[model samples]
Target: MHTSHAHTLEAARYAALAREDHAAGELRPLPNYALSAISACCRAQMAADVPDTTADLIAVLDSYKSPEELLREAEQKARSEQEYEEQQRAATDMDAPNRAKRYRDVGTATQVIPQLGWSRQMVQAVEYADDGRLWLDSNGTARLINRAGVPGRVVASSRIRLLRQAGYLRSENDSEAHLLVTPEARRALYLADLHPEGIHRDDRAAHAARLKVALTRRRGKQNARNEAARLPRMDVWAMRHADDLPATLTQQREVIEEQRRTEEEKATEKVCTDSIEEFAGRIADHLDDGWALNFEQNPYYLDVRYLYLVHTDGRKLRVKGENCGRDEQGAALPAEKLKVWAILPDTDRPIRSDE
Candidate 1:
């Protein structure tokens, strides 16, 4: 009849009742407040049942204001049991959806076999054997490899050379190719293979579509501008007496100022023009009122200047043009070209141009 033992039994009873409510499909967890009251009641009830001295048993029951309060407290304990079970049901149901998206080839070793003897190191086990020949294991099961194979001599040499040219591989040996996949490459390959459709293939297709649209729009604008610039002048009278028209100082001054302004504007436009134009259309498409445009004047060249544009609350774009110089660390930055930027509230800026 110790108070601590009474408390332990009371808490255990609540736990057992909660489990029963879970079996009955009730949806919540037992709260601590109700359990404390249940413990106090158990202590009082046990004191009476133990056939202790009449004064001690009466004193234990008298601790409560009335029998009604004790009964009401017990009813709250039952409600706590109901609530505890409800919470457990909710958590179990929530995990079920995520489990389906995860593709785990567990337990059965037969389903997954290590890929071997591939001609290329980049070939992962996820890719099915090509050319109707099982280049992987001699066992001939569709080798679903969770990893990439080692690069052979041809892949080490020629394939590495090809990869460097395509900007996929870089090594100390300019001529000698190094055929090894880094841990980052392995992870990328694994993630790409995990999807229903290959990630690289989907990305490549989307990139190609974007490139096609960009090229088309660029060429269309260029063609239109060229056509306008190439049109014949309609001045037959000026051609007959070209030398007679004396130049006025005002007109000459006006022409000079116009030329200077055009040169400055062109210089400013160079800094961020290409990078901005390429990605600006995407930003403009998504926002209203649009981004801001700015330019930087190069100290070395009077006519040469960098241009930049910043969207009020958008991306932070960086540009690197042909005129920019590398730092001591061999890092390149935008200088003569336009470096367009979009302002974002957060620390992580949108760098769509580079990555």
Candidate 2:
């Protein structure tokens, strides 16, 4: 009935068509076509005196200017949404895959240190630097949540040493210090410890603002002192050997022994593999030694044999005259001629739980 309502309905109709056309894979919307269609439909309704329908049609057309206009708007909105989602995913990845919790206080943070002997409050959040130094988030503010925290002092040192020796932590950053832990170290710390109490150290709040070097960074200075303690007392041999040949012989012997051990392992592996193949082959061929076996030709021989060998390490070998090829004597076969199949040496052996 009202002109404004009729215009609005027509505009809405055009927008609906434009969206549908976009979904139907239009290269670009023909805005003029959409607008004309809506206008014609509105006029038709008006001529019929269906004012309500006319108003609706007008509204639909007015909602969007043209098909081209609607396509551009939708594309922009979609792009913005996609960009936002990508940024969110990137942020999530930086926070240790699926873990989001931050360790800011010593009490809360110590739960992350593996095998650390220091009190919870002394170790702060483990941090990495551009230069190789394990910075203990000691008495410093956490950037993640902006809270103060402290790392265990002594335990941090010991743990860093262990990590370095374990070859998990590396001196990649190469600052004056020996090693730098990546942020993923936090996840490693989480795997090491999960504390029930929070990390806030009430007593150390005053010292919480200070940044700390991991105990590993101070190890060089401590090792200097250890060198003095390690000084060995020596006795000069008055009756020395005529030459250094004896010492050289001892070093050569060590190398020879190492090579021998390596060769032995290879030989053992070969023996085990050979045993498995021999046992498997005998079982696949239905012939028990000396026995006369009668059987229809196997239609699925390979499939049946594969199943028989499944988990062979657990079962004991039992050779019987089960349809093996008939022998020259035409008598039932005995187990002995079957070359008593050896079980895969180490595999067939029971595993010790302690091992």
Provide TM-scores for the models: 0.18, 0.19
- Tens digit per residue, CA lDDT, model 1, 1-355: 4765665566567767767767787735533333444555556556646532335534564564477877887899999977875674465332322333222311111121111111223343212222111122332212233335432212123323332343333333333332234333333334333432322233234334334444556667556444322211213321222232233345557889999888777766544334445555544444435555444577778644443455666554433332333333434444333343443323345434333
Candidate 2 yields a Cα-based lDDT of 0.40
Candidate 1 global Cα RMSD: 31.8
Off-target runs (Cα >4 Å) in candidate 1 are 1-162, 165-167, 199-210, 213-355
The weakest ten consecutive residues by lDDT in model 1 span: 108-117
**lDDT tens readout by residue for model 2, 219-250:** 56555345322211111221122122112334
Report residue 297 deviation for candidate 2 (angstroms): 26
Instruction: State candidate 1's TM-score.
Output: 0.18
Candidate 2 weakest ten by summed lDDT: 231-240
Error of 2 at 304 (Å): 13
